[model samples]
Target: MTTLRALTPADASGIRRIYSGAAVTYLMRPEMTASEAEAYVARVIEWSRAAPVAQYVLGVDVAGDLVGVVKLGRRPAGHGRVSYVLREDVWGRGYATAAVERLAAYAFTAAALESLGAKHHPDNPASGRVLTKAGFTCLGADGGFVHYWLDRDGRRESSGQHREGPGVSPGRTRCPRGRSSR
Candidate 1:
């Protein structure tokens, strides 16, 4: 089962492990040191306490273990941007897709976001697939990244696989095989 929850100080070590992998870091950031990961966790925890909740840096848990992170940053005008990175060992297992799907539902409903944008490194088609499966339409590549967008109404209009309403239960659901290291 995959779940998204708030990050805690205890998640620093697992964050370090996920951020240290080459495939993950290549798409997300430069390799992170132990201290860097801890500091990152602290910053995210602080962000959670903000009045408007400008950002959500959620820990992606799979069967009780922290396997990755999914982030959604609020933008102007009820819009947001989504991104995610997973531990290399867990790639291609559909965890990223499942997490993204749940995140989208939350953004559209609980967060009251009207639209969300995403981008993936051109070389990482798997990330693109994850976004598409989550109902994001391609907006073409720009500045070395392939961009995508999902509007709350646009998602409802599409007759795709993700037609379910925003009330989707936060339970285990099978997803397509893909990685989302954005």
Candidate 2:
């Protein structure tokens, strides 16, 4: 099961665990050091607690175990970007896709976000597939990364299932506790 909830300072440790594990994976190449990853987690926790304008950082976990994070942030009066990372141990388990789906739904509900999008390093097809499953389509290549967008209707152009974006995808999974999907 996947959940999207508000993250608290207490979640910093779990978030750190998730991201630290992630940094070693291909999803986040040129990984950061442990201390740096810890600092990164601290910042995410701070941001989640602060709830800055046009941004929401969430943590993703499964069955009470912290595993990943999903982030949705906008550039102040601009489009929002959705991004996620999962531990290598959980790869190929569909956790990434489920977390993205829940976060997309929350983005549509919590904020009047016009669209939710993400980008994956060109070398990472798994990331691309996860975003595609969440209804995001390739907008074009930018700075070597493939961009994707999911409009307000939850309709993802890249999914190829709908020409128009649907407000939310067909499934609305349960939101777990202990962490939010970033």
lDDT of each: 0.79, 0.65
Summed backbone clashes in each candidate are: 0, 16
- Residue 127, candidate 2: Cα error in Å is 0.6
Could you give candidate 1's per-residue lDDT for residues 77-181 as a string of tens digits?
888899999988899999999999999999999899988888777677788888888888665555556666788875523333332222222242322234322
> In model 1, where do residues sit more than 4 Å from their true spots?
154-182
Estimate TM-scores for all models.
Answer: 0.83, 0.73
Q: Candidate 2's C-alpha lDDT? A: 0.65
Model 2 agreement with the true structure over 26-94: per-residue lDDT tens digits: 554554556666677677666666645556767676787777777888744445778787777788989
